[model samples]
Target chain A: MTTTTTTRAAAGSGSGSGKSARGVAPSGKPFVTFEQANRRLKWALLAPALGFVGLMIAFPLAFTINLSLTDAFGAVNAGSSYVGLQNFADALTDTRRFWPAVGRTVAFTLGAVVLETVLGLALAMLMRKAFRGMEIVRTILMVPLLATPVAIGILWMLILDPTNGIANHLLGFVGVPPQEFLGSVSQSLPTLMLIDVWQWTPMMTVLLLAGLTTLPEEPEEAARVDGANAWQRFVHIILPMLRTTILTALVLRGVDALKTFDLIYATKGPGGGSDFEAETLNVYAYGLTFDYQEYGLASAVLVLFTLFIVAVVVVLRRRTERSAS
Target chain B: MTQAIRPRRVLELSRRSFGVLAAASVLAACSRGPQTASPDAPLRVLAINHVWTQAISRYLPELEERIGRRVTMRMLTADQLTSSFNVKLNASATDIDVMTIRPLQDQMLFARNGWIADLTDRVEGDADYRWTDFQDAPRERSVTAGAAVSVPVVTERPALYYRKDLLEDFGGAPATLDDMLDIALELQRRSEGFFGFVGRGQRSGAVTQWSSFLYSFGGDFTVDGRSGIGSPEAIAAYQYYGRLLHDAGPPGATNMSLEQAMPIFAQGKAAMYVDADAIYSNFLDDSISTVTDTVGFAPFPAGQAGSVPHNIPSWSLAVNEFSLLRDDSWEFVRWASSPEMVARLQSEGIPGARQSVWDDPATLASFPADLAEAMRVNAANGVGHDRPEVMQVGRARDIVGRPLVSGIVGEDVASVAADADAEFNDFLVRDNRQQEF
Candidate 1:
């Protein structure tokens, strides 16, 4: 314990002074310098992680950028000539499929994330106190999360099938007309978003529940002593304390919602629907790559999509930091 | 003290032992030969999930005996096969020795890309192959640019499948498009919860089914290498198709592909379904279908022109260009396409491309007589290509199919057709430019 405290103090002082000096051990031997040792240890721990991340993320990003400038398409090994920004220009100018896909992507992400966050917060608040069958309720909440996305899509397909599905059969019991759920162009995207919310709301609930557990009871006690109502206490104290956690959840869910492919692909296929009504940017880019083999154009769309995601994250992070301060 | 000393000595000994074991395993792994197949090695074949391909898989023992090697088969859906083969062939992967091909959809594109090996010389060299024994339409469909790239396996034509009982009540099968539409509308008006017609309605996938309608109306997607979808005949075809489906088709028809549409017809919910004849077995099997005995096949109804259906090779067997065991692959393909195998497959109720199988007494005895007659007539009058033959076939289909879906949903037919024509022309021009490069 004495050695640990001394080493921490020495490390702190070395960082503060920005100097390279040997830290004297409790035993008074000439031990390693805290400044040099800290630097070496920091790099030693981070280098492998950074290398792995670079290989996974940076190489693909750089390759996408390079491919976006060329006319590489059709056969895998087909020779390509550098076209220089033509693909980007074409993508930006493509009003037929690209712009509509962008609109759908933004709409889908916003719809799913907002619904999940609100529903999750409400459930978390309700579950804050211990009650009977709490463990069972928690386990039940985890069912959707445990099932794979493709399985969820196929399950929903059968449930929502127009003529034979149980959804319509149940509706018939109540005298409601049979509705085309995933089959209609206008209803398909919203139905998919609802499916997304159903699967992911529990995840947000768990995260917010963790945050709720860590909250200080003293603040609520003080607020109650001051004659604050339940709503007032929640809004003024609990919400502010949970801002960072909310932002973290948003970032986690937002990125995933933005690039959702498997559910849509499994349910609707390449162009999304018959009229491409449910086509989002990620689906469009995938179709360009795999279906049409327009590699250069697909790369440009992906680069643009990545930039959009990064910009959204940066803004959210800034907001989080501001709230914290 | 002795316990501590013994633990240290044991740890050191175990470390050395582990090192020796790891070295021995590495040496054993390195001594194994490469994955490339020899003449005696098992042949790996990739096939689309279809009745014909499944039949081949079931008779693998016989195939093995004929080829003198063990056989393994991987089956995938048509869509899955196309996407996977595209990636695998592009990488020149030799993991798949033989694979199924769709001549109308993939023959030109794959042959142009040099992904499939040319089988012309092999066919010429084999005396017992009897290449000419295959039907003319299927043979032509399998050949691209004067080179035989694949051997036709399952030949199918789009035919009108209707309930014989329903049709008999409605004054028998309608002979023309107008008569068919009127009969459907009248039957729909009489019956509750019964749809009159069902076909594929998904974009890009519906184009092949729509081509027969387009052809019957004296319309073509291209005429003299130019876009003809905006022609008067084409506009009429689109409007007619829209009216018929909108008035009589089941709800949510737009989401229905052949896989979905076939069930609706087989369940007796719809009176008529026009699709590839390959799915006839689905309607005939009493285990899966309710309308087995009532289902009747007819050549597609006539319009401005006489009855014109798509007699195309739906599936074929092709050799991978990059396969290390090319000779072995050829042997498998040759065996699969031989007369004896074709006849055997036909006798088992699976369709075949060989003319000999079509004429065989046992084949005729086993097959549905009326359906066989319809298939023969349609084959004689069938067009070679179902959709436009181009490298950008998928894109072309999408361009044409968008208008078709819009028409079905009651959009302005002329404007949609015009837009599709413009986009199709642009695609053709772009494709031509790439070809030149």
Candidate 2:
């Protein structure tokens, strides 16, 4: 490959005028043509990035796919053999934990993303106009985003404590009964979603605010001149213009919420409490991997989970494109 | 041509240098041998962050001198240690020379996977080791599948902790489960902000404490490799436990683990709490406990049969099977498990597994007398393996514990036990099949 490239360079140079001033040879041949050098530089810059993706993403994905077809359970060196789709069959057929986990994962992701997007847009619109103390509000909003997820979970645990938490104390003043927020299986998942919204809504708000700032103001001005109300202007003009940005927020938040592990693990622990009520696919797969050493089953769950996320993203992207057109 | 030649020469030089650097590094790594340090080097130890393991930190210098090597220790919490050790040991990591093990919880799993080295022969050969000096319950529990995989380091038996002042006003200590419940209810009715009873109510974790009740009711988790959770005695035990915790336990008892329950009892909010005797110090520590002076210890109250508490070694020290410095690792284990080390641990107010240490005058003087006596009586009548002694004990516990939780949450006891029995039987069959190969 090197010899062919060198020969091509020499041949091309022979047909050209005396070597160009930059990167010229004394023998009247260019050391390297701009085109060739540009191509080489492109590859050189991309090689490390491509290698990184291959090592970190592609390799693990491929290995997980391979493992999903085997009976690799227990310790890493416990000696496993190929079972060929048994794990996939087992996971797909499992209604007790697997199906419920998939449902919770979907509920958690969709619930968190939709709520975050709505709340974030409201905040973004509120902050779109410059005002005094705007910076302080923005900084306070970023606090939740900056805090670690596990730390946030712990903080929420304290705040939601049934007996001594400030939440119950405030509720008491209003004649409201104290709720078993994290302790009750019925309430745990929704409580976790609320926490997700708290931590990530600011992120969505920031992203949308940037998009809002960049939006062309002409359309909204025209809508206002036509006597459209504030709600009408927002719905028809500003929102349509921010289709791609809305989808971007959803895609980002949705993907993260689907893989919500640390928050749940930090608070509820493995198997997502007694009845496995809060056990999403990520938590279930994690328990299978670390708790039970069911590597093959976990790999299968991960493969399916990746596929589900991809499908969701593809559908959302198509909708975004349709709205754009 | 000269310009092109100059660039090529520089490229070639750079490539050759890079190759040389890579090769030299590879050679250096190869020469370093296994990740384990040399026998004369510092031994690496991994332990869970507990009072017992923390006590060992103070004696590191003494242990180093005795073993003729330097010592280093890394302490992690129980959850952290389990996950870290699982990943490390599974990958045949040699970085850890010695590690702590929960003999009843982890022995069979670790032994089956060949993660821990067998210490039977070495332990027997050491003259000063006096392996027989260790309590029988802890000693026997250390052996998994006939191999002495670990040496007992911290032994604990479940004991009843109650408010002495409250029990004294109610005449005396409750001798039976019925009497205990009656007293708990009376105290709770008389006092505001005081719960009658508190224990681990979380599934999986609750099973460990619940086993004492199950055994007292003449039931066990498994008998002859089959689940006994559906037996009449087991049902009665589950129902009784559920009634007590539901009627008298703190609100949201279903969520409380040992960490949550201990605090309630220590804060004088709960009249009685049953858990590992090792945590008695937490209640006795004036800084952490509000009722340190009023706390009293007793054996678990009798049920249908007799009061039977769990007498299991909570922590053990074992050499990693993958350690290249096996002898050195064993030396560390030996020194850590020595009677002298046990005595030191006892003096530090951490319980020890060695009978010699427990019987020592110094140990007796330093530890709480009532709690120590309760521990001895509990151990004498204790049942081994608080959770089931099975492969995938976590899974098994989850199966049986679900019913316990459901019953506590107002489900019918008989139906929940039946369902749990079916699931457990299925698990046994599936597990047995997996073991066939």
Index of the highest-DockQ prediction: 2
Point out the worst 10-residue segment of candidate 2 chain A by lDDT. A17-26
Q: What range of 10 consecutive residues in model 1 chain A has the weakest lDDT sum?
A: A17-26
lDDT per residue (tens digit) for residues A1-325 in model 1:
6546655776677666533345444455444544455565565468668757976999889988999999887764777889999999999999989999999999999999999999999999999999999999999999999999999999998788776578988988898887878878888999999999999999999999999999999999999999999999999999999999999899889998999988988778769888998999998998887778788899999999999999999999898788778
lDDT of 1 at A288: 88
Report the first chain's TM-score for all candidates: 0.85, 0.87
Model 2, CA-based lDDT: 0.83
lDDT of 1 by residue, B88-185 (tens): 88877778889898887777777777888999999877889999999888897778778899999888888889999999976777778988998888
TM-scores for every candidate against the unseen true structure: 0.88, 0.91
lDDT of 1: 0.83
Query: How well docked is model 2, in DockQ terms?
Result: 0.37
Which stretches in model 2 have alpha-carbon errors above 4 Å?
A: A1-49, B9-41, B189-193, B433-437
Classify candidate 1 by CAPRI docking class: acceptable
Q: Which residue pairs show collisions in model 2?
A: none
